[model samples]
Target: MPIAALSDLAGKAECPLLVIKVGSALLVGKEGVRREWLTGLVAEIAEARARGQQVIVVSSGAIALGAATLGLDKGGRGSLADAQACAAVGQIALSGLWAELLGSHGFTAAQMLLTLEDLEDRRRYLNVTATLTRLLDAGAVPVINENDSVATQEIRFGDNDRLAARVAQAAQASAVLLLSDIDGLYDRHPKEPGARMIPVVEGVTAEVKAMASADSNSGMGSGGMISKLQAAEIAELAGICLVIGNGQHDRPVARVTGEGIGTLFLPCRKASARKAWLGGRLRLKGSLVVDAGAAAALERGSSLLAKGITEVEGVFERGDPVAIVDGAGQVLAHGLSEYDAAECAAITGMHSSEQAAVLGYAPRSAVVHRDQMVLK
Candidate 1:
């Protein structure tokens, strides 16, 4: 199977992790959780594991399933609260279904619900990563979904595609299989008469971007071709191959992997995924103003030092992500802070030796460690 072979090509030092993202449309049919389809997918996953692969599933449809149980209108939830309530109820069904099916196939299923902040915060990112590593080591499959019940932002609009990419990076996965309702990327919409499928993508260029449509093919899922393309971009940056295939077909995952029935995007990533994430995201909790020397050192792959820092500009806790800015207002790098805002303010201009005197306890010395930072 192409999906199974992809990891052998990457040759990860540890057992290769593979992520499968199932959208709401395929997961929740008119009756509720689509048991027949899910059972087949789990069977394929079990087969993959028998061949020494670790799989994680990122799924959507909590709200849809919950809405069905709650007797809400099929059109959409009336309010965000209603949607959240539905998710709180639906997540149980979703997780239980996965557990039941995977158990039947002799695999333990671990369920997790994550919010955006969980991955954005370095501290939380490490915790999640550690937990995933442990689970994989124990030979269990993880079933994950966005924490819709507590999502403050508008409910997940097929963000699971992107979330799948993030999970792949966090778990150091070699590939992601996004099982969708459509056949995969084409020259135009699949329904169009002359549309042609593109088999492999070395990179996501403008032409590739133009091929995607804003609307989803799956009437039930929020993500469309656009979301899948975005996911491909993230996977590319993280050096993880991502495939989009039609999951509605019988024994879908098996057919896609064995017959190579999907669009495969190759990866060309160079940095640690955590660092790539720090560089890619736009939201920074605060900025640390450093001198010219610090800026040059950062560019040459050095850590942020307290002695070079000139000022601390926003309130942030230790382990929160922040930007390292130069004197001229240019952002040099981004990284996780080792100290809180007040502590940073007090130690901004001090040397490593002097920090112990002011801080009462010895510190880690650098404001941000090189391993935790990514240069712009």
Candidate 2:
């Protein structure tokens, strides 16, 4: 299907949240920031916001700009220290330029830098999600990048493609767009005589990955077709469609709708918000074994109450994900706990009103609210 009319894809959600990834090649040049390319793209982003869509920009170019400033070769096997130095220097210019450009258009640019550890930790992940949600709610555009300056090789994502995917998943975004040097996936090397660009991919299968093996590096960028495909896989699992397109042309965001030079990877079905919340996204801290009455209430779409809890297994703080298990030891659901393991252990099987009296503090009514739980 020629989705040149992206509304078809976007219609999947009202007030759709979109993640846009700008590669280093598109953002950096020998002369420095590509003012023309970025200005035009920012214009599209501005229009998109005016049209009521929430947009997040995941950008690269810190290392490239830093290399230029420090007289280092990014393409070479530079030491991690040298790379970090470049990121430190370039990040200032990168974030400032984005803020300036978006500011000129009456939009605020919120800068966020993240490392693998931030997304991997359950608590930090939720914190990041909250910040992003608030930024979007306040009508600010979030420009995020990898925290290369403080990140070690072990903790780094290495490529922003995966970073963008993880961030989009965390935000529970509706779609992701990777704007790069190439238009989209090709049947073979793009320069081949008859190689054709596949317009739409329903799912990321072995054949799709084989096609991605032909790298689409633009010399200055780190991610290629392989990395984009890896990103598509993440989007697929998150029930988010991803679009790959060339940002070299005018009105590049137009390509996101399946128009212009772009390819759309659509997920088979949309995953529920509950699944995205507790479905392997948040790392579980522990499990709470509840009595039969509590288990029945949970299945009936009720919140987890402290009075029904029989056992608390695991050392988890409040707001951490914990599984709810039945008396038979069968897993029932996963939800965020309102109380710490110690507190829950102490207040187990007690009424909610008794908690404040016993613990000398007023706690939320539910141990694990129904809204937070993903029932099995």
C-alpha local distance difference test of each model: 0.81, 0.81
What residue runs in model 2 are displaced by over 4 Å at the alpha carbon?
A: 1-15, 75-77, 256-258, 270-376
In candidate 2, list every pair of residues with a backbone clash.
3-258, 4-258, 4-259, 6-257
How many pairs collide in each candidate, listed in order? 0, 4
lDDT of 1 by residue, 1-376 (tens): 2333423422333336779999898888777778888888888888778777789999888988989899888523567787789889999999999999999988999998988778766678778899999999998899999998888653343368888987887887878889888878998887879999988887777789888987776566668888898888767767788988898887777667667778888755447766767764436789999998888888788888899999999999998889999888877777999999999999988888899999999979588999988765
| Per-residue lDDT value at 317 in model 2 | 94
| TM-score per candidate, chains pooled | 0.74, 0.71
Backbone clash pairs for candidate 1 read none
Candidate 2, run of 10 with poorest lDDT: 1-10
